[model samples]
Target: MNASTTGLRRGLQTAAVGSAAAIALGFFSAGAANADTLVPLPDGSITETLVDGTVVTITRTGETANISPSMGSTPLHRNVWVSGSTKVEVSNGGSGTIQPGYIVACQLTLGGKSGTDGGMSTTWADPDGAAKQTAKTAGNLSIGPGQAVDYKILDLELADPFGAEQHRAANPYKGKGSVTWADSTLGVSGCAGYAQARSYVKVTVNTANVTGNVTLWGQPFSIG
Candidate 1:
């Protein structure tokens, strides 16, 4: 695949200053030629250096990584609206074991209007426009031992019924949610050993005029 496409897949696969001062000084006197020349021994010489003269070094190493995904549910003012999108970020929190070739599947629960509920539906979509009514999975790219994958879900379409009862019933939009995704499934192909397989899925919800708080949860997995 192309670079853009590859990056997109990699992103969806996982389920996913200060300053100091210093000074240096030199002591020298120009007197008569007969005057004895005083030499300063290098007993850790004192020098007047500029504040920026000092150097600081930082080193990074290893292949282990961590992925984090966050989802938000916002109250829509309109009768018909979409749930707040979810943003997933990946971090290389030091080196750790991760599945080598695999994808991540995420699932979300779209709570419907409670109380005198009426017609309310929700739908989920991935970055690639793939629809996910429930939890969807994606992945199968190579993530350097210390690398990470991140992406967002922007398609959570919600349709709600217009009425005070419909809104009051769903007063406290409390629902159980889950996100399940895995890297590409690994297997032998032809004479080659294990290789990567590409797959992608989106997570979304279907609800409207949500009057309560929404929470999202995810399960963790590592690639071999």
Candidate 2:
């Protein structure tokens, strides 16, 4: 080959190898850095009878979790988008309110497990085999290892009669109540361990005889 043509061929070959190497590095970096997980959760249901013979049935369906890399870009941060619907049915012509939310935990077993001793720190079970929890909020939350927090799925804002802003976290219904949520953001920070989340629906019913609370819990899913 001529000297000029030989030099051009070598230059083109070097450029091709360099481009291939850069593409391979980018592919591996994306696989390690931006890997996302999508989980389809099973439906949850529970039925119980209140003190006044009021039959309450709570169900959660069409549940899913899309877990992605944290915005913080560290092991201590996690982000998730959840979607589900909560339905409540009260028998005997009763009226009630429905509160739908999620419980996020790090290194803790969620539903069907007994928790600590007393006060709001305790986790108890109802007659229908559903675990109960306290400590609910509508804002950002932080928890350590072996800790969990509850948050409302809705933050409906409205003005009171005195021209003040008020946040309503629950909805009221007569006999039946239903609520659906999509693309709800649930984030966790300062957790150095694996994280999980579950859905819960709490219903407070008022009948002619008594007032009671019934809660139903969904299956737990990982968020890493």
Candidate 3:
């Protein structure tokens, strides 16, 4: 072969080798990326991430009474997530007695990324105006003393967005969130009396790029 032809052939061979090496390197890089990608939780896992624009509805079914003396306090516990915004609806079922000179109220707590005692808490109730006594009723029951009350507390909505610290450590893709509900006995002065209370809550979590597994932990109460 001529000198120039030989040089050209050698250059072509070098170019082909370089191109093959580049393609191989690309394949390797892609495989590595795929391997590092996070996977969804396995079947039967408690934690779940809703797809963007997807709504996950958890309906609590049944009649479970969390009974306590109208004069004493107790904590209601559950594990839930706060991602996008969530709407919660609580329905009360049954009758209870709120004796005179006693005060009872409902309270909710939202824990930080570390669960309860790790975040902030907020309370809701009717304000007492000029009257020295405030009376609250649910259904056919009267809240003031000398009477029995039957009532339901309806549609309570809460919106949780990103940037808000998580109440409990959440798996970016696979762990559970924590939530708790309880009734207060702060001012109930009457002797111990039983108050029948039943509630059902439904929560819908928003979706995001939270990667990895997550789990929800709390004292399991009745959900029916």
In terms of TM-score, which candidate is strongest? 2
Tell me the deviation in Å of residue 6 in model 3: 1.2
Candidate 3, which segments miss by more than 4 Å at Cα? 35-91, 94-224
- lDDT (Cα, tens digit) per residue for candidate 1, span 1-224: 89999888767664220111111111222112223222111111111222333211111112122221111111111011011212221122111111111122222213422211211112222222221112222212222211122222222334557532321101111122222222212211111111111222221222231111112222222211
lDDT of each: 0.21, 0.77, 0.27
The TM-score ranking, best first, is 2, 3, 1
What lDDT does candidate 3 reach at residue 21?
Answer: 100
Pairwise lDDT winner, candidates 1 and 3? 3
Cand. 2 TM to true fold: 0.74
lDDT of 1 at 93: 15
Write down the TM-score for model 3. 0.20
The best candidate by lDDT is: 2
Determine which window of 10 residues in candidate 3 has minimal summed lDDT: 93-102
Candidate 2 residue lDDT tens string, 1-224: 89999999999999999999999999889768786778899998999998878899999999998888877888889888889998888998899789888877665434422343211123324322222333444445576655666668888889999999988888989999899999788878877778777788888899999899888877878886
Candidate 3's residue-wise lDDT over 1-224, tens digit each?
89999999999999999999999999888655532111121111132333332322222212122322221222222111111111222112111111111222222223212212321112112112111233343211222222222122222333468555432211121122223323322222221222222222223233343222122211122211
In model 2, the runs with Cα more than 4 Å from the true position are 1-28, 31-33, 108-139
